[model samples]
Target: MRSPASLVLLALPFTLAVPAPAAGNLGSATTQNGLTAGGCKAMTVIFARGTTEQGNVGSLSGPPWFAAMSKAVGAQNLAVQGVDYPADIPGFLAGGDKKGSAKMAQLVMQAMTACPDTAVVMGGYSQGAQLVHNAAAMLPADMAAKVSSAVLFGDPMNGKPVAGVPAGKTKVICHQGDLICAGTSTILMPHLTYSQNAGEAAQFAATAAGM
Candidate 1:
């Protein structure tokens, strides 16, 4: 099994610039309703968005990184879902949000329950990554077993690893100079550049999802 550090290194070369999608393409209206609408799930990628003061869906709209990821996953005929949560600083600094994480975990468990044979791939960015890690770690063993892989970007908790995800099945992507991952760049550009890596990251997520 490759260590998480090794996976981050492997992701470095693919983290190049790509044209940004139109602002109109940010995400789908389906996000407003979240994942509970219920459909047969062959595969699903649950993404928790980064920090926001907005309600559930937040303001982190489409042309969003997860939308690109969903497109890639969809090419493989896999379904995709975005999780809506209070991804705020207060939630993170509190160590973890009992209500928010529990809600996230519940959605995950529901997905697992509804799609017993479906492979689940979960991921997040920045604080959202931390939330996914916390939620996945809190899942019942059987539910956790259903999750095939986790892909995280600019995870603030990179140094303090989460407990549930096995090293082999998790991939972390921190840009060369992204300060969030402890890189030296003093700018937020690195933190915001994940859209450039959408294609590569989605491909990685697909492989992790066993497609």
Candidate 2:
């Protein structure tokens, strides 16, 4: 059997396509390396893609959010890094991928340590949102508090706090019909439409991150 990413290639029912690199900010590359490239910027966005999604940042959410954030914070001032993980359904069923969540947390601290002046934002979609919650719990309060903000779309853990992150600094955008936001595994139309909320989430992140 093939993975969901591959399955998406065979079927178009899910509409997994994201917004084409969010207006060329990412070009055609599906992966990102701003955090580990020995480069620092005004802000760092560590985003995790949804389960069964393509690349590290799924086209359905992360890219759109990145586009909005780029406009809000200025592309030159922003850096994006997508979390690497299996993004398989099994991981989502397991309450997010363990290794992925750990990596996200590490990236957060790494961003802070590497760029003391740069703002750090944790973000994700679908199971990726679950990873955001898990990653927040893995960090110490002091370190977590240092994180500038968090933005989650089509969240599986909606209405739940993002551990040590201040409620005011975190944004969770869930559509009313999105079953995943309601804490269920069922994927609904609302969940697939999170890209529409990208601007709103990005604006909130910009304010929270002091952009």
Candidate 3:
């Protein structure tokens, strides 16, 4: 088993964009290095995953996933960060481990605060999806409003709908073939099930464009 910090560090290479100072002193947005270009406003998108299992982001080559999605959507700039936590963190946190959740929530809030002008998008796979939802729920109403869209993949709402997420701006994508879909949680299923290797990337781009 990997230590929480180790897992986070390992996952960092996959999602972190270069850290850039938000324009006009809006704090620094965490982004992959060398991925930013001038004359483009940066947007922060948080990528969360399930069961503490890292996603394909670490394995992909070329630009970072968030940058690619941002480019696809034509954003001037983009930043992506992964929400790292132990697989059992949620369970322990729910069982009164407020410290852990609160700490994680604070980290997320800092990321959001750093990019005040940038639109925010939250995406998660499996367990990571739930973390994003929970983090979004914890945001102050004003901060939550900054979020342009939220995408939950492979995980249902699980009876905990993220408050303040505008219905029109939220989307859910799930794999029908994945057994995780059989749960009774509340999430809008994707139009097509089955695996789409690049589908997640495409959907993120399309959604960002719509925002």
Each prediction's whole-model lDDT (CA): 0.60, 0.83, 0.47
Report the error of model 2 at residue 168, Å: 0.6
TM-score of 2: 0.89
- Candidate 2, which segments miss by more than 4 Å at Cα? 1-12, 15-24, 27-29
TM-score of each: 0.73, 0.89, 0.59
lDDT by residue (15-124, candidate 2, tens digit) is 45443343234534456777887489999999998887777787888777888888888989888998999987778878899999999999999999889999999999
Q: Write the per-residue lDDT of candidate 3 for residues 92-143, one digit (tens) a residue.
A: 2242123333444565466666545665666655555566666777778877
Candidate 2 overall lDDT versus native: 0.83
What are the runs in model 3 whose C-alpha is more than 4 Å off? 1-41, 55-70, 74-76, 89-104, 158-160, 184-211
User: Whose TM-score is greatest here?
Assistant: 2
Model 1 stretches astray by more than 4 angstroms: 1-34, 53-64, 183-187
Model 2 error, position 106 (Å): 0.8
Best by lDDT: 2
Q: Lowest lDDT 10-mer window, candidate 1?
A: 15-24
What CA root-mean-square deviation does each model show from the true structure?
Answer: 8.2, 3.9, 9.1
The per-residue C-alpha lDDT of model 3 at residue 138 equals 76
TM-score of 3: 0.59
